[model samples]
Target: MGVDFSGPEARAALGVVAPFDMELDAELLRWLPDDVDMLMTRTPFVDDVVTVEFAREVADEGVVADGVRSVTAGRAEVVAYACTSGSFVRGRAGQESLLGVMRGAGAGEAVTTSGAIVEALQALGVRRVAVATPYVPTLSHLLDSFLGEYGVSVTGHDGLGLEQRIWEVPYAATAALIRSVDSSEAEAIVVSCTNLPTYDLIAPLEAELGKPIITANQATMWAALRRLGRRPTAPGQALADH
Candidate 1:
């Protein structure tokens, strides 16, 4: 498992690398099972930049390569590139390219948060999508551009301008931000960004919003498990419902 800020339940064993500011140990300790062991990798970046260059740089060759190296060194069962926008911005071709690089670095299997989102959407038969992110407007636009390349139409998109600190964003704030979007025309809702904690809220959001809700962390976990041929025993909601 590649935990993001939102944390995960017990029964999952994984490592985490924060591409942004996130308190992983506290969050995970709250929910992680005692039997599961975890390691943390921190990749921090400054907030001042017009192009989101740091976010891109960490995702591009460095973070992915480093993450792959860590996974290989640990001999972990799986490794995932945890940023949704980072992987999607690289597009499908770029995702494959990164996966190849990860394999070369030492991972037996690799998956991206973006690819997981796509798989989750497709599993639920989602075509038209409404998206919300804690990213700035520029990165939000980049995400829209990336999703477009995957043949998923974005019916609407909203960004909270929270940037890298999105992990600290409260769940209520995220739910409220997502609720403000007009997703009636979309087949599903995508809350993009692993750093933002959205896993525990996925079920309630789906029920209230009346559409399948796919979050970055949830999708990434689901995809990585699928790669390991493991079926998540959790209840039906989000991608697990499929």
Candidate 2:
């Protein structure tokens, strides 16, 4: 076979450490720029672990380290841990632990999805935000608490309380869920679950809410590309414009 150095395989790869069976490729395809590429590895999966119990149960340092080892195997310019709840479960220390593991495992640059969201909010100059999430109230509360520690206020929250098949949520329902949590006091709105889809709704929601709209996947993708020195460009979303 001729040495093929074309398409995504030849591009600067964005390594992703996804929660097992995360169904992420569809979401990544929507949020990431076509010129770049994603190389992914999966960690151990936990069934019905989208709740507070699950969050607490799965915040193991060993699991994070193992995931890092898997994803950083290739020549990725950057590696992103792409589980929002999992990243924030043990708070910032957990986030740092994940990043440290990635770097220790030889990632050129590393970021967690939760850290990416915080960076996204800061870059947009957003202080107060409304949130839409598919997690139960306890997990949703953790999301708020995590953002609060970063100086971002959670002015509103709408938790759908779903534990399974979050990725299958339709855009219409996700849009409506966002509208339910929106507040005039919010500088931005965040859709908090990586498994919950938001790529098609970002620009429209930003326009409707009259502020920036942030989602777990979009933020992580932005952070991975930005860390590798890529600037996202989109027509409406502030995160993209940066």
**Number of the top-ranking candidate, with TM-score as the measure:** 2
Give me the runs in candidate 2 sitting further than 4 Å from their true place.
Answer: 1-10, 56-59, 233-235
Q: Could you give candidate 2's per-residue lDDT for residues 1-242 as a string of tens digits?
A: 99877744556678887877587577776666777777887777677657776765454657766766666666675888888998888787777777787787777788888999999999899999998898888778888888988999988899888887888889999999899988789889988877888877889888777889899999998988898778654557778777
Which candidate number maximizes lDDT?
Answer: 2
Output the lDDT of residue 21, model 2: 54
Candidate 1 wrongly placed segments (more than 4 Å):
1-17, 24-40, 44-51, 233-236
40: Cα error in model 1, Å: 4.4
After TM-score superposition, what is the CA distance of residue 181 in candidate 2 from its true location, in Å? 1.2
Q: C-alpha displacement of 172 in model 1, angstroms?
A: 1.7
The C-alpha TM-scores of every prediction are 0.82, 0.91
Q: How far is candidate 1 from the true structure (C-alpha RMSD, Å)?
A: 6.8
